[model samples]
Target chain A: MGAPLTTRGNAPKQDRSRATRRRLLQSAVACLAERGWTGSTVAVVAEHAGVTRGAAQHHFPTREDLFTAAVEYVAEERSAVVRDLPRPAGVREAVEAVVGLYTGELFRAALQLWVAASNEPQLAPRVVALEARIGRETHRMAVRLLDADESAPGVRETVQGLLDMARGLGLANLLTDDGARRERVVAQWAAVVEAALRG
Target chain B: MGAPLTTRGNAPKQDRSRATRRRLLQSAVACLAERGWTGSTVAVVAEHAGVTRGAAQHHFPTREDLFTAAVEYVAEERSAVVRDLPRPAGVREAVEAVVGLYTGELFRAALQLWVAASNEPQLAPRVVALEARIGRETHRMAVRLLDADESAPGVRETVQGLLDMARGLGLANLLTDDGARRERVVAQWAAVVEAALRG
Candidate 1:
């Protein structure tokens, strides 16, 4: 979870500041996954991060600021995970990997925040922007994993469908134990993607 | 919106009673879609339904009962709509129609409940049961609409994937205007399904 502490401007305090920010963001993600948006209060996040409330406030002046930063932080982490995945040998393995990504802890945490943002006016715009950015990055990863040509007639949309199906499966898994069923869907969709590529 | 008033045991009071229940359920749906779960109180629903507080209480004694009933009610309504859709001439039209069904008012209303239920322990079990029932009915509708064989290798899963993709698109549409993008995905998926069927 630790990134290499690079000094931006000031050399002396840079490492400590980066470590503090990372801890706070990670704590916020945990709080969101466990307690949801309304329950993930600043004080609770600060306590979970082992930081004083004042320090937390100093880092994030408002609840929205804290959550927005946490959402972006998690997105970057997950993106790196996806980018660093060992290239799958075939469509089935690739589909499985993507599905695993969607059904993981990061997706669960993001889902909680998404639900919270839907009904919250102040948080809605930021969440929407974050989702758009994440969606683009995920699509790019899918295209690369599939070795797809974006200029091809139906290739891009097919990749989008794959991504959408994974998301749908993730949503279903939120309330139901659909692991076996999700595997079958992934295999079938993988076959379809393979066929689409062949054409 | 009106169900036929049946006189199974009580003759005279059945129609008004059924109407009252329908109104309450519909009001609950509106409240959920507009204000989410926390804001959709029994009092607010009763007022929206134009029913007396006592009558609302008589119909649904608890908040859980009201929401659970509403969730089931909306699912049944949406299922009926899907079942009643005129059969399409081909797969593309069928896919388009199915996507339309998902992105409609019912899906939006149901999305709110789903998000609410995911985090609320008391609501989770009922939502899960409702989702399973709804999933079964939807799979049946898709199979019928596509003239698909469940026993055939990979066919049932392809159908399931289509349903799941529509659900994902519906979820995405909740926060962002993904209608144009959703249509592209639907068209591309229809092409894949058609090719698979031909093969």
Candidate 2:
């Protein structure tokens, strides 16, 4: 469902327009989560938002635009959660923070996006770009927390490896439904990445 | 497209039966790959296979059955490839073998299955179970290659971490199309895992 918008013509209802856009984006997220990428369409998004398809289209002209916006929305939400997180004192804290964030609530929407992108070529590139941004930002966080120089041999790859494990473990936990085991696995992950960086 | 199969009463020929199944499975792969899980129906599978819908239904009684067989077939193919690979002499070789194979061709098919499973609740549990089996098997292989006991302080997590990274990097590469960089990343991954195990 597309969010209701208060356009220039409806100056007094500008807040309504902003509200509509927000509703539409939220509806799109629900639709994507429910239907996967290919199954998600403008019509469905509109229906989900409880708005007319025309209204949905009025808010977002193309499905691609909606999808791109939704991804950005997800990324922004994730970034917001981690933004104020305390900087890790060392490798363990950094690893724990990264793993914890990834394995927690912050990951649900992004995982949906990841699954969607896997099958849709048109969607894959954009999702990949978004992920690349996440990777770069996360690496920066790791560098600050680990006190590693970027130019140091294997520093980037070391951090990348940690991110990779976080993702892998996330998928594994989702698939396996072993919450306790996943926690153990994640803690173990923190240990390995910590060990790797020490050397 | 569904395969052209002979009736149970009388098979067309042994080789022809094999060919029919092969064609049907290939069509299923193509259809699923092109359309995502929801888009790939038995009728579409049949059409893609150049066979009749009736024939497809006759050979595979249910769409779930057909999809399950298709997944198993792909898993078997991957298992075969891994089996045929020469035994690694030590930790480094084993990690390299697993990472290289995973990040290459095997990763694409696996990602498709992962994406497909997300849309099919019926398929998700089974797919998840199969993936867990694979994870455990890979972990076992790592334990053997590294000559580490399960009781070893960090062996299990380290092995799990390596497998996790292999999968994470594999999926990331498939989505991002950063093949060359992924290769380097996997190589670096192997180095890190080897280092962890050694420590």
Candidate 3:
């Protein structure tokens, strides 16, 4: 399949541009996780990505744009993974799966953005909307993976409670490894979740 | 009963100093809750407290000192409230008390600082230590209030789970009222806590 001369000429350049943007976004996320909002300025992220300031600015004109997009980009990736995940066979596995979603680098990055967004007027609305969308989707995923009946009274709240607990666990992990204690907590939750669903 | 001239002269001045300090700390918390860490500068807090910048600085030499002290001051007050609270009659009431700790303006003020502290190097260690102490005391208070027997297997994790769930609920309430949903979640948690403790 032969393409027109103009199309062929532009393909490599467009690919290069896309690759650069990806690098910047990924670098932004890493920077946010390690240094937080105060340290993850556009120039720092640009240097981290090995891209010119001009190129980063061209891709994302504002600090808000770059950071929010960075979180959103990674969030979308996570969402896709959750969607493609195989259905859990039991409550324990399902609990593990949902808890797994909130305990890593991406969560750290998002947490930084969230704190900054709460204070930054320009950044607040976008981050809030993005988070609300993610919250709804994650709840749906939990319901689906758990194979629980939401039609029953008290079921939705139980599921929401689990999600909130997972988030708090994630918050705890930010300060310390919290892995050992977290496992205990998760195991306990798995039991609570099963009994709630069954009853 | 007559006091010396020096002691009499100093007492009112010291009273004024203590009053000024109290006003500043309260103002700092109010600012943190409404405007977050960024907007709640030393100057802004001074203005809010109806104190001079000099007086504010006299009490707290740096921004970190002021904000951390603000949170700590409020936290100590809250701790007093917790310590003095009558023991709950049952799991449901105990859960309500614990969840109630994290859902109000104090929690919001503390949250803003927690996020800010996670990023600010100077603020991190103090805030982390403060939170750890608070976490321990709160945990102990919860144990006492719930009448939990920690000797039982999984009992500790169950209590910790309740705490983390309460924090997650607090986080959720930051952006939205989440009242109706929160009531249901807390109701379900009441049942869960009762079973976990009984088992």
Give all candidates' CA lDDT scores.
0.82, 0.69, 0.87
Q: Which candidate is the best by TM-score?
A: 1
Candidate 3 C-alpha lDDT tens digits along A25-82: 9999999998888889999999999999999999999999999899888888888988
Which number leads on lDDT?
A: 3
B54-172, model 1: which lDDT tens digit per residue? 99999999888998788788878877877777878899987887677677666766777776776789888887787788778878888877777777788888888888888888888
Error of 3 at A113 (Å): 2.0
Query: How many steric clashes does model 1 contain?
Result: 0
Per-residue alpha-carbon lDDT of candidate 1 for residues A1-199, written as tens digits (9 for 90 to 100): 5445663446547778889899999999888877777678999999999999999999999998998789789878877977887778888887787777688667777887776777789989998988888888888888777777889888888888888888888888887678998988888888888989767
Question: CAPRI band of model 1?
Answer: medium
Question: What's the best-to-worst order under DockQ?
Answer: 1, 3, 2
Candidate 2 residue lDDT tens string, A138-171: 6776676666666867777877777777777776
Off by over 4 Å in 1: A1-12, B1-12
Q: Score residue B1 of candidate 1 by CA lDDT.
A: 48
TM-score of each: 0.91, 0.81, 0.91
Ranking by lDDT: 3, 1, 2
> How far is B17's C-alpha from truth in model 2 (Å)?
2.8
Clashes of 2: 13
Q: Candidate 3 residues B1-199, lDDT tens each?
A: 7668779988888999999999999999999988888788999999999999999999999999999899889888888988887899889899989888888878888888887776777888888887888788879878988999999988888899889989888888776678898899999888877887896
Q: How much is the lDDT of residue A29 in candidate 3?
A: 94
